[model samples]
Target: MKNGHITQKIGFSALFGCMLITMFFLGAIIYFTVVRGIGAISWGFLTQVPRSGMTEGGVAPAIVGTLYLTAGSILFALPLGLACAIYLCEYSPRGFFVNIIRMSINNLAGVPSVVFGLFGLAVFVKFMKFGISILSGSLTLGILVLPIIISATQEALMAVPHSLREASLALGASKWETIRKIVLPSALPGILTGVILSIGRVAGETAPILFTAATFYSRRYPDSVFSEVMALPYHIYALMTEGTHPEKQTAIAYGCALILMVLVLGVSAIAVYIRQRQRIQNA
Candidate 1:
């Protein structure tokens, strides 16, 4: 018993150390980004267009473009992923084909972002003739995040107690009705958690947009889905690599990074808030 106690204490100490280390790194990144970028957060910096070789101006266009892409991606991915997960978890029979599909989706999550960029270039940009627009980029990002959504939704659906479904049916409720009313509400928190993770990824991705939608510099803001737009990730990349005035562009880049982080964090906070409320109400 003493040996077991000592081992358990050592394990707890190790786990606590790991958690502290993870928090430290995450906090360090946020601190560094905010400290470097806070000076460039004026209203004009956010609301104006670039001028004088993009050395002087705000990132209004890029900000709008990133928002468009993130929203578009979610709009495309969520319903499709949710439907697919529902079919797989609630309707599909256990079999070799289902196992294959599951494995394929798991493998897809591991595929590199750059590979998705290349695929988007070939299929969406070239074949579909989307012409380097927001539509193409959004579709690419939607695909990139589909696996995550599907996996999360599958887990959430499965986590609904079997007894709950049986009880609903015992009340003479149809299968679809029980799933629609009972299962879906119970799983929404987990679904939103997946959405939170996807938002972080979709907002920060540069490569897929680099090939599909983002322009290095645009004189006009995008007015349609077909129009090319300046996005924050590509804007940051361009400021670092393509601009002549390094110091100013670098500052702007950091500012853009801060804004992007804030966008993701803000959305995530709202999702987490909703999820918590849902969990409490359900409890």
Candidate 2:
């Protein structure tokens, strides 16, 4: 009895220690980012246009470009991803072709962002003749996020109880009708969470946009999807690499980092809130 009690105590102690370490690492990251970034952020800094070199200027254009890219990517990716998820979960039969499709999607998720950038440069910029523009960038980002969105959506659909589907079928609902009314509504919160996460990834990505969407110096907002835009990550990279004033450039990098962090955190908070509400409703 004493030996069993000691073993249990050891297991609990190990689990607690692991959790404590994880929390400490997370806290350290948050503290470093916030401390380095806070002073560089201000209303004027966010609203004003960037200046050449290390001169203090605002990041309005980069901010706007980031928003445009994120929105465009989400719009392009969402429908195709949802459709793929539906086909995989509801329609596709177990076969070699289906297995291949699933493998391709999973492999795509593991590809490096820089490789995606290279692919975009070759396909979108050269073959499609889109050039280095926002449209090309958005398309590339959409491809990058597709696998994630599809996987999440599939999980959401699968989470809906089989009994709910049966009930709808018994009530004379067609498969489409059952999915549209019963399955979709129950899965929406999870879908939204996936979208929010994808947005965060899209916003943070620098490599893919570097090849397709970004320009070195763009004082004006993009007038159309084909126009080259200045994005926050690109700005951060440029400042760190080429700015004459190293200190000021570092400050700019920190500022951009802070903004990106805030955007991601805000979206995550909303997802968490929605998930909690969903749990309560389902309960």
Candidate 3:
């Protein structure tokens, strides 16, 4: 018994040490970014167009463009992902076909972002003639995040209590009706959480948008879906790598990074609030 206790203590110490290391890294990143970038963040920085080769003004257009792409991708992906998840989790029988679909989704999730960019360049840009526009980029991001959303939604649906379904059926509810009424509500929190997380990814991704939509220095906000636009990720990349004035551009890059981080964290916080409320209500 004494030996077992010693072993458990050692195991816990190792686990705690790992956790502290991870946390320290995360906190260090946040601290470094905030300390380096906070001075550059201001209202004008958030609301004005860049001037003088992008070293003299704000990133308004980039902010708007990121929001547009994020919204468009979510609009395209959520329903389709939820539908696929429902079919896979509830309707499909356990068999070879289902296994194949599961394998395909897993494979798709493992695909590189740059590969998706190339695919989007071919399919959406050349074949479909979207022409390096917001619509093309959003469609590409939707495809990129589809596997994630579907997997998350499937797991959420599967986590619904089996007894709830049985009870609904016993009460004369059809399978579809039960799913629509009970299972869906229970799973909504998880689905929304997945979607919110996907939004963060869509906002930050540079590769897919680089081929499909982003331009280096657009001053005007995109007027329509067909218009190419600026984005924060591409903006930061261009400033850091290609700008003539390294000092000013680097400051702008750090500022953009800080803004992106804050935006993602804000959205995540809202999602967490909603999820907690849902769980409370369900309980």
Tens-digit lDDT track of model 1 for 35-63: 99999899998999887888888999999
Q: Give the better candidate number (1 or 3) by TM-score.
A: 3
Whole-model alpha-carbon lDDT for candidate 2? 0.89
Q: Model 3: C-alpha RMSD to truth? A: 2.4
Q: Between candidates 2 and 3, name the one with more favorable lDDT.
A: 3
The full ranking of all candidates by TM-score, starting with the best, is 3, 2, 1
Candidate with maximal lDDT: 3
Q: List the residue pairs that clash in candidate 2.
A: none
lDDT of 3 by residue, 67-174 (tens): 999999989999999999999998994889999989999999989999999999999999999999999999999999999899889978988999999999999999
TM-score of each: 0.89, 0.91, 0.91
What are the root-mean-square deviations of the candidates from the true structure over C-alphas?
2.8, 2.4, 2.4
In angstroms, the error of model 1 at 262 is: 0.7
Total backbone collisions, model 3: 0
Residue 44, model 3: Cα distance from true site in angstroms: 0.9
Per-candidate Cα lDDT values, in order, are: 0.90, 0.89, 0.91
TM-score of 3: 0.91
